[model samples]
Target: MENRKAIEAGQDITMQKEDFAALWKTIHLKVTDTYEVPPEILWVNGSTIGTLGNFSASTGKAKSKKTFNISAIVAAALKNDEVLKYSAYLPPNKRKILYVDTEQSKYHCHKVMERILRLAGLPTDKDRDDFVFIVLREQTPDKRKQIIGYMLENMPDVGLLIIDGIRDLMYDINSPSESTDLINLLMRWSSGYNLHIHTVLHLNKGDDNTRGHIGTELNNKAETVLQITKSQQDGNISEVKAMHIRDREFDPFAFRINDNALPEIVDGYVFQQPKQDRNFPLTELTEQQHRKALENGFGKQVVQGYSNVIAALKQGYASIGYERGRNVLVSLNKFLVNKRMIVKEGKGYRYNPDFHY
Candidate 1:
């Protein structure tokens, strides 16, 4: 109430006189202080990636399986065990997880809930108070933040808060003031409630950087920033790496969506090509190799569009355990067409079954 009055009286909160009474309660610094470090709620290889009262983000391009990685994190929090090398240890008193989704329909949000439950090995049909899921897809940005604040206040036991699609909380992601304000809110909410907040954002198109001014602020202030990207070798696989971290960086890892639509680690998976040598020229394929590639890439259906052709060929090459980078994949597509291996029929390209292969 006093703070409200001060605001009404045109007082800036930061410039106001010190609240000496609250100093000791808020700060623990002393020359001889022996406070233990904050406990970690999320870990990779036994190294802390998420500590209480801090925020982190995961960013990727569109359809890069970012949500799948986040699902594992949320499931680990609920199960209090390791999921995809991410483990969470919410104190018994603070076992609740509050997941706020701002971009998906309610049905899709429900599907996400089901996915989390399944990943945690919990019954999907049962409702649990400790796991709260909410969708703000219809709400205005201001209202969405307001509702989240209200929910957080009411759910004091929440140990982990996830703001999936954090971009949706702002009217303009490019606004510098908005970016700073939003990041400040994250700091306040996380510290005020003594909880860890995990957020998700999309990478800028054609680049690895997170989107907008808000992304810049997030990188500067976040406890950790993780990047997820579709493997250049196989688009179906997503590799997660630490973009920024406060602790020792963990080894990069990859996961692929399985038949069950759940992400599973690609166990002992090795990429044939090194990252620095991705642009190496494509080697000529033998006639038998060409035949197999056609069988795997196009099968029977012929795709006319350029974008569609590249996608089909990627899956085809990956199916035959052939590692082809994006550039190489494009080159191989032209190579086959030029070699008369895949003949152009009308407007579409079709594999010639009897082209002297």
Candidate 2:
């Protein structure tokens, strides 16, 4: 009877639902040691420092400016600590910034480091000791999990977590559900550990959506979303547009990267301003202009079959009997999204002549 009572007591302790709930809640609301809002030296001023709790992925078209280049901006800030004082009146406290470069090589980062340091007029040599770089290739799920676990365990002091090209870490970008799961995992890690997370992602060729299911979810969940687009004037220059896309607290702003060897944020110059056409447009514009003009005419002609289709949805529209909407849109490149365009919530679609023009 005594032995049986002891066994029953042990079972009761193990089955305590309330105790498990409390433990779960504690992990969910994990907080760092310091209670103050950790300062994330942002690339743009007044930019809402994105949530460190979830993955904030930046996506842009191919040959468009890279969102990850902002990493260089941070490195520049760390190198030229004085610049930090301009933004925040107080002297900048040197904190450990960790970069997990899943895309670029150490050699590549070094080149970028040289250009950034030289432009900032800071000692380039100092970066070797100040920054910690972990280079990982296209890692499998198990491998990525292992790497992340190791990072959390070994580098607890990391103030910023930059994951260059999140696609390299996941197998699929088109699966929003799957992507969300991966993002949630990363978010859990970031939140659990209380670290700022920045992930680099590639924009679908003709759309803002990233490559997979998780890509869209990542973008939607991020505290902030920044898009890098090529400068229409100078192909060499890339424009960075940032918005508190998800976070209500953020304000939107735009800036351009200059032609300097090392790129830094310049006066928020309005690229929309009219400027002289330094290069002859006639030669470069002939083929593209003609093709786009034709497409524009077709798009404006009114998509007959998709009359009742969802305005925001660029593809997979059906008109009950019209089984060829996707096919027609693809062939015309008119109904389907050729490039990101302005479309109203319920107006079906609008052809931005300026973009296609």
- Candidate whose TM-score is highest: 1
Candidate 2, pairs of clashing residues? 173-211, 173-212, 173-213, 174-212, 174-213, 175-213, 176-213, 179-214
Scored by Cα lDDT, where does model 2 land? 0.53
Off by over 4 Å in 2: 1-19, 22-24, 27-43, 51-54, 76-94, 116-121, 126-129, 243-260, 265-268, 273-357
Residue-level error in angstroms, candidate 2, position 238: 1.1
> Clashing residue pairs in candidate 1, if any?
none
Model 1, C-alpha of 304: deviation from truth (Å): 46
Assess each prediction's global lDDT (C-alpha) against the native: 0.84, 0.53
Residue-level lDDT of model 1, residues 1-357, one tens digit each, is 998898877754454345755675566666776766877889988778998889999999999998899999999999999998787899887899999999999999898899999999999888999999999999999999999999989899999999999999999998888988999999999999989999999998966657888887786678888889888888899998887777777888899989988889998877554433334333445677768878888888877987878887888777767766677777677556534466554346777676533
Best model per lDDT: 1
Residue 22 lDDT (model 2): 80
